[model samples]
Target: MSFSIIFFFVFFVSILFCFSNSDEVYVINTNGTKIIGRKFFTVFEDKPYAAFWKIPYAAPPVGKLRYKPPNPLRWLDKPVYNYSIPYNESCASGRTEDCLYLSIYTPIIKHIFDFPVVVWIHEDAHKHSPDFLIDEEVIVVTISLRTSIFGFLNTGDEFAGGNMGAKDILTALRWIRDNIGHFSGDINKVTVFGSESTAPIVASLLVSAAGEDLFQRVIIQGGSALSPADYRNYNFEIMNKLYWNLDGPFEKFNRTKLYELLSKSSTKKLLVASYDLFDSTEVRDNQRLINSFPLTVELSGKGAFMNKFPLEVYKRKITNNAVEVMIGYTNLDSLHKLDGFVRNRKLLKYLNYNFQYLLPFEGRRDEYGSKLYKKIRRKIMDFYFVNGTVGERSLRRFAKYMSDQVIYPILRQATLHSQVSCNNVYLYRFTYQGSFSLVWNTVLRNLNFSGATSGDEICYQFKCKSLSTAYNAEETSNERLFIKKMARLLGNFAKHGNPTPHSSDDILDGLQWLPLNPAKSVRLLNMGRELKMIKLPEAKRMEFWTQLRNEFFPDRRINDEL
Candidate 1:
């Protein structure tokens, strides 16, 4: 062959070799379908492991199934494989019907030894899309489900049942039990974990009959059952009114008409209308209006759902010894108090002004306003560390109130309940301020007040690739240590159904995890590495929560005393 031809041949072969090595292939289980996934490597136990991303576990929940429970697909037919980029559609924001899908991440090649499964439910206050739960190690699965109206609409009729979102979770669990073994996962060693709003739902499941036996381990971070009182006051009457108002009459408000109207409306409009009766402010602001309803209302709604059909299968409590539960909150979880309207002065003033007149307790409006302001400020400090911003003064007060009424009480209850219910229950308070940069950001001039707010912790827990990008250098180092601690605890729990080795010292410290025993629950405050377990002054914790509950939700029956 000519020298030029030989040179071209060698170059072509070299390019092919590089391209082939760069790509990773995945094989479908049935009928030999195959596709190439992006190849990435991560260091695991000093060994490199390959990972594949975005494997689907359920058919898209678009169109007719939009507001309904998830129906996972079976791979019974020939594997229909295409290398086309997998579905990464952003979750339906307002009233989207196209938000059904699940993603899977696993080691490229499964070994004979089965690995534990860690399924994460992403937290967007349960509003955002499902792409947030992408982790490379231990098989990670996340599914998109209906949020807002489609998920939790309470028509207050036998036909309008709540828990469509929860039913989605059940479907995902059943899928795991039936198919995860094929991925070299032990069906029995599944752990479910999430933060914020997701945490509360998971906790509810732990206590509810519907959630029994769905997973062997559960972790709740930063959220509890102490939701707002307004959420529960869902006016099913409003749904009927809006349905008729939009469709023009009852004859047109049938399922077909309802679906047609829903299909035509924007996701935002649907959410606003769905929650208009519960809180007009939420509708005006386009926030999660229904979610802002009273916690008492939510508990009652859940109870009603449970009463309608006893989850017979889930009620058979298979030994309280069967599952391991870990519940915790951040050292400064009150930071979330600043998440919404507090950031906007106009909105705050508007809400304060409106409430001053519309609310029956007009005289106490200033007190409520002050309380909300304090919570915002404290949340700013706890999450971002920098205060002294434009809204700092108001936010500080809001943060304080939130800490006293929401964060502390919720953590205390979880700790107490777990301790009393299961010997294996473990509780923790993440006091580590993470990296110094993160701490510095809390104080950095213009930049300091700009970033690092509540919900920032999520940046580190999942999808973070570098400590530098994740947090400040010094703070990143601290965060690394903290992550290590968290991962160790999680891994240990998955392995033995206990958070740490069965040692007396560990057990003692574990036991000291602030009890929820209404009379003696302690709130563990972690400062740096030091831990201080302080008993919540009995009068403050119980009395305050009781008063708050009664004042906020007089018509509803709620277990807020805890």
Candidate 2:
């Protein structure tokens, strides 16, 4: 945690993180500003990458640093950082806090020194950008913080000293382990990846000791560590601020009346007192601010990123940190649609309107009761649509029972509790459906849909020229051998934490991918076309939703975080 030593300070270019890749010409100096990078490739593939745009590590949460956490990043004048200004344009009217900012890329190969860093924890908010696996020579970072109420609005007390969006991802990996060795990168081969809603902030920075060696390896796709809005404790920060004050205006904003009005307001008057509790369109609506916002529950001392709860810190830090894991999903990643349910799927008002949009806490479905929520939505539509009905003629078995009711009991309980606290865990189930899941509908004039949902493998690992403007040489050779077999299994699991590629053939003839054995019987794998690894594609419907969630909510909080 020490790096700020680029003190040979001179001046030529002032930003964009250093320059040139051909005939080498370099210069980097993190945090005190001054970087220069540029050199990209991949119209079809030529490798050579080296991006570096907008690299401030932190500082700039603004004015008395609202809700404070991230800090480092010394000076700043500002230059590149503009992934299309907060998701395609609209800055949602306020709160910006100069957006922390980070990006790095790197891949020019040849003598690859220390290389092996992967840091990309973005998600749907501000629509995650940084172009897929930066052509994987590995070093590819991408960051930014302050989402909803500037990082999950907490304040259960102590002038809000909690989870500042996982402390702006541990102060941007402590400025990439003291400035990623001037872009050759390799803080002991960091990995910390994420997908769909930042995979519970990378499984809350993998059961934090403030994310120990900064990272070792963990790749969660389609989320885990009980992701979908996990507040492990602080009793969900007083049930997310009284579930946003029972329709807000702080049904008496607790934490002892907003600790002197949030230490004397003005982060735009505490975000206009949380948008004046949604201008009382009958208070805190929009699915109660999308099921009461997300993330926040750090509090519990000394530079905390996560104090507990991710299966009690992955059962005491996964067998003493031998830490290496890879998780995945996407066999119809949560599918369900019914705009006129193909002209009435037994319209029990469209099967109770897509079974109240396939429940998963539709904001606490009025705490169950409409005759026990139609007898728990008819025991989950007769345990998945057969004699219990759902017919636009069983829409592909209702999109595989609404995509295994949102990805098989939280990725089969985070791969059976990280393979019984880490002995090794790897799992996949993408099952291809590319061409960006079938695009091309010149404004609904034709083909606009298919499979591949929940974060469509980020359009086959980068290069989504709007999914396809042309791809007919065997679909451009199966999209360049599926983005070089997903960058040789995420750059051979960021240089050998194991995704197999022993001296690479760029996969397909060197296939291995094993390691998830809930007691045998496996065979399968892929998103490019053909790859198999069996036994898990709804293993008897994820064991009937894990024995119906251990016979209904057996002490839920995702069964106390699995």
**Taking the tens digit of each residue's C-alpha lDDT, what string does model 1 give over 1-562?**
9976686567545434545653444433533443333444442222233333444555665566655446678753533333224444434354345555555555555454466777777633222211122222355556555555666655444433556666666677777787776556778888887666566666555555555676888777666543332234445455565686566655444655665676577666666665545446443233212343222223244434233211121234322334677776554345544455444544543423333212111012224346654553343334322342334335544444444434544553454354446545555555444343232234322322322333455544554443323433443454555444445455666666665464453312542333234344444433235445554433344454455436543424223244
Model 1 residue 144 CA deviation (Å) reads 2.0
True-vs-predicted CA distance for residue 175, candidate 2, Å: 14
lDDT of 2 by residue, 65-113 (tens): 7677777865335322222112221113355567677767676676776
Question: In each prediction, how many residue pairs overlap at the backbone (N, C-alpha, C within less than 3 A)?
Answer: 40, 14
Candidate with maximal lDDT = 2
- Which ten contiguous residues of candidate 1 have the minimum total lDDT? 356-365
Best by TM-score: 1
User: What C-alpha lDDT do the candidate models reach, one value each?
Assistant: 0.48, 0.58
